[model samples]
Target: MPRKGIALVISAPSGAGKTTLVQRLLREFPQFGYSISCTTRQPRQGEVDGKDYVFLSREEFEQRRAQGYFAEWAEVHGNLYGTPLAPVKDSLQRGQDVLFDIDVQGAAQLKLSLAEAVFIFILPPSMTELERRLRSRALDDEATIERRMANARQEMLESRWYDALVINDDLDTAYDALRSVFVAASLAPFRSPDLPEALLDS
Candidate 1:
């Protein structure tokens, strides 16, 4: 039998840079599929449908949710976002690992379903650095930045629950560390069903 694919579930606080890491991973390893999500928000500039997200109307999103189309769904800031079941299921069935840049809650639910998944958590170098990154974005108000920093503190506490953790102090160093994780996990001893037989033969 072929070696089964692994699920790479990565979660991070808002300013931890997991999203950037995941994007780089996909670009470097074209064989891996990045899980494209469905969202009820309008697409941003230069974002493509089905690639960036499966943009949906509120009614369509809710209708599909009712029809059991999504593997996971969550509402954020009054917008609904979800991961559709088909792409992920198809990728795994074809022995291709799927990478996800989801939040702590989504990662938890995914683990319950994809028990064999390798869960990873990304952390900022420090709370000070996290606040700095958040503020640097200039996208949120001061109150919002403070709220995110507070949430990051709580989310950082959950890092211990993951199988692997990487601190993004420097992008180059962090990417190297993240790449090593995927490479190691893919070839882990437990992944091969023929390990015992091969060992006996050797």
Candidate 2:
């Protein structure tokens, strides 16, 4: 029997290595596909439409919002970001899981709409370590880094809402844990009822 596709949401503060872990998971697990989000923010260097993000003007974004196009949408730092409903529904209908790398707000919204969504919160070892990792990147100024740290605290507090928590102290170990989660979710009786029959045949 074909089951609904699972919506796997991954949330983490900047520099928590969540992005790297998700990339690795996609590479390792071909059964899952990343959901490209639409955003009103201007694309950074090297970001391409439909690949990095579905870049849109504020007017376009607002139009879609009015039309009820988003499953979940939020404004962060004055930029609008939203997950399109069509692709996600289509993927699930086809039995392909969709991975969403979104912020806490979006994750919460998604959970309300997709009751079966699997939420995963990623965290650094410690706040001190998180700061070190953010600064080491040298991408943001001190003020920006400080803001991110503050946001990280808030995000951490909300981690309890997630279905799973991954401490990215070691990338390989964290990846393994995430893989195990996907494997288990896929094999769950509710997700795949055919498992019992297959096991019996084997």
Candidate 3:
């Protein structure tokens, strides 16, 4: 039997280091492909279209949403972001694992759509650490930071829905734990079936 592809959803609070963990996991595991999200938010200074995000106009994003093109979408801070279903479906059909760095709502949507998806929640060691990381970014002012922290608390409340949780206190250790989840998921009975007869004959 052919090796089935897996979708891994990584969720976390704003400063939980989820993005950094996803980057390292992809770099170390070539078999996994990153799923680029489409968003209506303006691109930041160093962010590239299609790389950081598929930056789309508000009209375009709404049109796609109307067409049901996204597996999941949400509006935050007056900006919309969504995970396009096409690329993810294509990658899985091509026998490549797809990694989604999405929020709790998106992850829940994915679970409903793809029952085989591996949901992993990356978390900070403590709320204090989470706040420190958020402040270190220096992108938001006090009001925005406070809003984000509140959102983070909500995100934490949703962590129990995930298949696994990795506390990202140490980057290397967290990466290892995340990688192990991927490895185990790949080897699971559902994803990897018995060897084909044709191959066994050789």
Candidate 4:
């Protein structure tokens, strides 16, 4: 029996190491497919157009958004971001898991839209450590970093409703925890709709 694919949504505040954990998971589990999101923000250095994100002009983004092109979309840090709906549905129907690395806002939207998705939240060791990590990146100015810190507090507050939480205090430990969540979600009976019948037939 072919099992239905799972939608695994991993969300975290900026500098929480969610991106690194997601990358490691994808590398370890090559079968998992990544959902490249569309964004209205300018690409960061070394970020590719389609590979990293479907970078779009604000006008184009609004047009497609109005057409109901996104499964989930949110404004974060003053930028609009969205995940396409079609590819995700196609992959799930084909029994190929899709991984979404989005923020808490996007995750909440996805949950309302796709109730069965497995939602996981990543946390930094502490707010202090989180700020340290963000500053180390040197990507944002003081004001921007301050704004992200404020957002992080709200995100963490919202994270209480997530199905699982992995504290990214240690890289390897966090990866193991995140990987375990995926492994467990894969075994959920709901994802294998034919399991009971197949077992009885066997």
Alpha-carbon RMSD of each model = 3.2, 2.8, 3.1, 3.1
Provide TM-scores for the models.
0.79, 0.84, 0.80, 0.82
Can you rank all candidates by lDDT, best first?
Answer: 4, 2, 3, 1
List pairs with backbone clashes in candidate 1.
none
Candidate number with the higher lDDT (1 or 4): 4
List per-prediction Cα lDDT, in the order shown.
Answer: 0.85, 0.88, 0.87, 0.90
lDDT of 1 by residue, 1-202 (tens): 4556778888899988877888898889888767889999999999999899999999999999899788778999999999987778778767788887788888877876677788888999999888888888898999999888888888888778899889999899999988898888878766677776877978
lDDT of 4 by residue, 1-202 (tens): 7777889999999999988899899899888888888999999999999999999999999999999898898887889889998888888888999888878878888888778788999999999999999999999999999999999999999998899999999899999999998899888888788998889988
The predicted structure with the larger lDDT, 3 or 4, is 4
lDDT of 3 at 100: 81
lDDT of 2 at 80: 92
In model 3, which regions exceed 4 Å deviation?
A: 39-67, 77-79, 194-202
Please name the candidate that would achieve the greatest TM-score relative to the true structure. Answer: 2
| lDDT measured at residue 158 in model 4 versus the true structure, 0 to 100 | 91
* Displacement of the residue 58 alpha carbon in candidate 1, Å: 5.3
Candidate 3 local lDDT, residue 169: 97
